[model samples]
Target: MDFEAMAEYLPLYKDAALLTLGIGWAGIAGAVVIGLAVALIVHFRIPVARQICRAYVELFRNTPLLIQLFFFYFGLPRFGFSISPEFCGAFGLALHGGAYMAESFRSGFESVDRIQRETSLALGLTPMQAVRYVILPQAVTLAFPSLVANVIFLLKETSVFSAISLMDLMFVTKDLMGLYYRTTECLVMLVLFYLVILVPVSLAGSAIERRLRYGSFGN
Candidate 1:
């Protein structure tokens, strides 16, 4: 715990931390979009669409994220599908993280009651209408907690992008640690950086859940 060692690394530490947050934020945003789309496909139980969605979820969820990152970063180039490291990293993160997210949302949908659905159908709603108006609203409420956890996980998982040279916070931190020899100081800050993003996300999720619950009670 050499304070001076950390002081020596302060500037580099700041740079690396910023990079990590930037990369993580971008990757998480992409994951949220892809994940929600995948989740919806599964939730609706579309014929071929559901199967394809299931296949994607199974394929990505079962494998190591690092392997997927390598596949996107290295293997794709062999097929003339070249992309930047950041692009590859983000693609891999979204695809992989989205798999789990699909499951979380699907489970939430499954948790929805049969009566709510029946009531919606009785109200002259089509299947899509029932889902969009009746089922999905409650499902999202149930899924909110799990989704928030997954978002935090996905954000933390963004660190893996550094392996492919994404220059995210973790990548920057590593470089800073090497340069300034303040491993403790920089890492502590890095942890704080992660919490900075994750904590607010968690709070936002809670707020949304509260609103949903309020709506549910017709209050």
Candidate 2:
């Protein structure tokens, strides 16, 4: 509860917070891309590709991020594949988040009427053009809520990145507490920093959701 003492660690927390955001956003962006790709493949039912994408979704969605991080950071070296801890953290989050995102997007894709594809084709749109102009936009609008939730989920998952020695907020908090025995101060800062990071996302998601609900953007 010592304000002066807590102020001393502001720089440390700021840096850690930045790192957390960098990794979290990077991972989330990658997840969205990977998820869309997987969803598209499965939605189109591309024989071999669909099975592979389905297996990927099942595997990553069913596993824990910590174990995945451990495998990437610790286990891979056994096979001579050495990745930096930062890459491992970001990549693991992407792979894990992608699985859940795939389901969310796939559900959205399915919710759209199949006749839209046929109609677009009858209008002389190529298959790829139909997906781009008709299918994807509607699917994204339908899946917007789930996509926002998944982004938030992935951001929180960044907490586990510390397990791999990345200087994320949780790592800095734990390290400071261990060194100074100021557990209360460290924990308060941890909560505050996380709120700082997550609250905006929640607000932004709500704002976007409202816009999509009432705005002509979806039309």
Candidate 3:
């Protein structure tokens, strides 16, 4: 292992890691918004909109993120819709992650006891009020763990951003390996950088899940 080569490449990898995190988190934020909106529509069984959201969830969940990125970055140009690589990366992640997030939230919403909704309505609360005051709180709590897992999954998926020509951590690592033939050093840095990003998130998620579980038990 060439320690000098690894050290020399550190700055580039740092920048790329930041870029990856920025785009990944931005995509995750977008996914949360899209997922929440879709889940609400599905929960309410909002006529045509519910069907449309269902179709969207199935379409995105079944397809590969790379294909989605390619469509956004390359295929769109044929139709004169040229977007930046950054936009493609973030947008594709959002669309892909949104599908899974929607499912997670929808399942959480449905898991709430039907009796609670009925009771809220019997107490003269409007449908939206019932959701806001009764259903949403418990559903969000139920969904928090799944949301954390999805965020981590989406962050890892950012490695595919290289396919769209983004200079993410994976891209920089591969570029350095090819240029300097420092495969061991580059791979080591890649693993280290990823662990640096993911380990804390995993640990934090576990901690939060434990707390939520305990809270649920009224301890």
- Each candidate structure's TM-score, on Cα atoms with residue i matched to residue i, is 0.85, 0.97, 0.95
Q: Which ranges in model 3 have alpha carbons more than 4 Å from their true place?
A: 216-219
- Model 2 lDDT per residue over 56-83, tens place: 9999999999999999999999999999
Task: Sort the candidates on lDDT, descending order.
Answer: 2, 3, 1
Better of 2 and 3 by TM-score: 2
> What's the lDDT of the predicted structure labeled candidate 2?
0.94
Q: Tell me, what's the RMSD of every candidate?
A: 3.1, 1.9, 1.9
Candidate 2 TM-score to native = 0.97
Q: How many angstroms is residue 173 displaced in model 2 relative to the true structure, after the best TM-score fit?
A: 0.7
lDDT of 1 by residue, 7-118 (tens): 6655765666566566566766776677778878876677898889889889999998889999888999999999988677767877888888778778888899989889
> Each candidate: what lDDT?
0.79, 0.94, 0.92
Looking at model 3, report the run of 10 residues with the lowest lDDT sum.
Answer: 210-219
Candidate 3 backbone collisions, by pair: none
Query: Which prediction has the highest TM-score against the true structure?
Result: 2
Poorest 10 consecutive residues by lDDT, candidate 2 = 210-219
Residue 207's lDDT within candidate 3 is 80
Which 10-residue span in candidate 1 carries the lowest summed lDDT? 210-219
Scored by lDDT, model 3 comes in at: 0.92
Steric clash count of candidate 3 = 0
